[model samples]
Target: MITPAPNVPAIASTPTFTDTEIKPSQTIAANTTTPPTISETLTLPPVSVIATEVPPVKSTPKLANIEWLTKFRGIPGIGVNPVDAWLNETGTTSDPTCRDTRSPSCDKHYRDPLVDNWAAIRLTEVKIVFYKDELEKLITFSGVGSSISNWFHINRVLASSWTTLVGRTYGYFSLEGDAGNGQRFFTASPYQGCTKDRIFTLVITKQVASCAFDRHSSYPQFLFVTGDGWGYPENMTGIALADSFAILIK
Candidate 1:
């Protein structure tokens, strides 16, 4: 037998794996590339509300000459009397008649109705303001505080009953105090709003003798005159539309 060289091939053939030689797959390779980062944006809506209105608060203001004073609305229907025509050249308007001619009551040491009932209680301050052409002129008791002791005004007749000086008649003002305490009276310069060439002024009285006047004897506490087409208790010519007065009780 030739033995064919025992069949030893010139080159040995490499061994190949059969189906039995293979094992099941084990580890899995992870993906390396990161996913492209995604960028996101958000949005929203709006809202609203409501409210009410309120008035302004004002403090007591200081008074000054030609200073901007506040508008004062005094007791309405009160008339401002024209003082110029009533008072004579000597500043004498009232006489012994004491009723018709009672411009400045020529009595001293008069009894105050407020003082008689309440001894310590007296009007501590008084404020007077005149309005014309939408402008204000203010005067206070403190302005003329010095010479006043117990000063007040009185009306002799009803405003409607007074035939003379229909719109210019303001009742009498009594200024009773020690001799020359201070500026006893004030004069309001003439303004061209009234019926006549009337210069307005404040009325104050002086003590001539011991003559004392009691307020209980009078019927009307004050008089009102009609001016600028208004009357007392009903007419507010200067007072309602223009003028005003106020008082501070201490």
Candidate 2:
């Protein structure tokens, strides 16, 4: 019976693996987590922008009341003998007469109470000029201080006076023009600073007037023409600063 026992191969037993045990030939998979999905989106309000503007400024001075200028009685075409009347009104003694032999004219100088008392300006002398025919030709207001401090007050007074007489404001840009009749108005100033010579003139005669000191040919002559507007002669030098204002009448 022993001999008869066939030599059968011994059967191998199957191995069992525990939960923490891993076989050498087996591969283990890594643990992965699922991602969460978003449901809503965020939004913001839009911004806005805006713009702005501005205005311009003026450089000229304000105009003043010039009623005092019209108060004078010595204005041309006023009295039978305007020169004498003006002298009487101004209470001036005709002691020192302004006589020019070459030119057929007579001039009387005086100090006017109205001008002296005027708070607006300080004028020392007023002169009345007459032609050979004894007709009033020119009335001049003069004697401003030569100081620069007097410029503002003087300018204001003259400007106001011009505005009152001409019915228009005095501007450096528009100095002279035809003021009706055979008359012409002119305004001028010197280029120099701190000088007290300025003149505002109104030519009242139809004929050309002698601006010369005498009948000398070398002297200047003033010719006034009529039109819409007229300007001073180009050859004319110096601004109208005569420290005086003259009104010539017919």
Candidate 3:
């Protein structure tokens, strides 16, 4: 330390630094070890690929023809809804095999009388009622040779009433609206042409029968197919005839 003169500030000593030597925490040896080489090559079996063939498309019915009448309305502890009333005591039979005392009564048989069936029956008035929300449609009617049949021409659709006819009625009539505008109608047929073996579907929507009723009508009605001398040949060979019908709403 040096002495300071009077009224002069003493100088402070500063620390000096030089280059320092640094060493690693531990010395590592060079890796002289080598992985063992694969002495022999492995062989794999050859694989064979097979091509798959696709089958041809076949025709089938368009609608969901359920066995509704037998399973619901006429069964034990079951009956038609209050809104539904049968105008004809005998319902039409598209296929006689499905006909039984348990089936709804109608007056027409799509089955030919010569082909072992009951007499052709006729119907007049009918009523189908349901809650407005419960109707998503898909209601279906069955018949033979009706695959290509004009569903809308079966008969005139009307409003809910006591004298409603519900069966094959031959005539051209108009409903209040088209499709979903106010009313809608849909029909489907099997992929195959109408023979004794083929079945067709007839659908009626919850549209307003504005002829006698208003657009706010809750029930839609149908008439019977009274016109005759139409449809497929009554007699055929090995037709495997089977006619059935069902309707679903809810």
TM-score attained by model 3: 0.18
| Candidate 3, poorest ten consecutive residues by summed lDDT | 74-83
Error of 3 at 120 (Å): 34
User: How well does candidate 3 score on lDDT at residue 225?
Assistant: 19
> Which ranges of candidate 1 are over 4 A from the true structure?
1-74, 78-118, 131-135, 142-198, 201-243
Residue-wise C-alpha lDDT for candidate 3, range 1-250, written one tens digit per residue:
9988678677888655444623232222224445456553554444432222445578785434422232111111122211122212223334544344335543332222221221222122221221112221122322322211222233433422212224433222222223342222221222232242111111123433332211222323221111121222113221111122222211
Off by over 4 Å in 2: 1-104, 109-111, 120-225, 232-250
What candidate 3 gets wrong by more than 4 Å, as runs, is 1-12, 17-230, 236-240
For lDDT, the strongest prediction is 2
**Per-residue lDDT over 82-186 for candidate 2, one digit per residue giving the tens place of the 0 to 100 score:** 223332443232322221222322332223344334445553433223222232233233335522122222233332223232333343311123223232333
lDDT of 1 at 177: 16
Better model by lDDT: candidate 2 vs candidate 3: 2
Across 53-161, the per-residue lDDT of candidate 1 in tens digits comes to 3445786764332332221122212222212112211222222232211123332111122322333443334444443344544334432232223333322212212
Cα deviation of 248 in candidate 3 (Å)? 2.5
Error of 2 at 128 (Å): 13
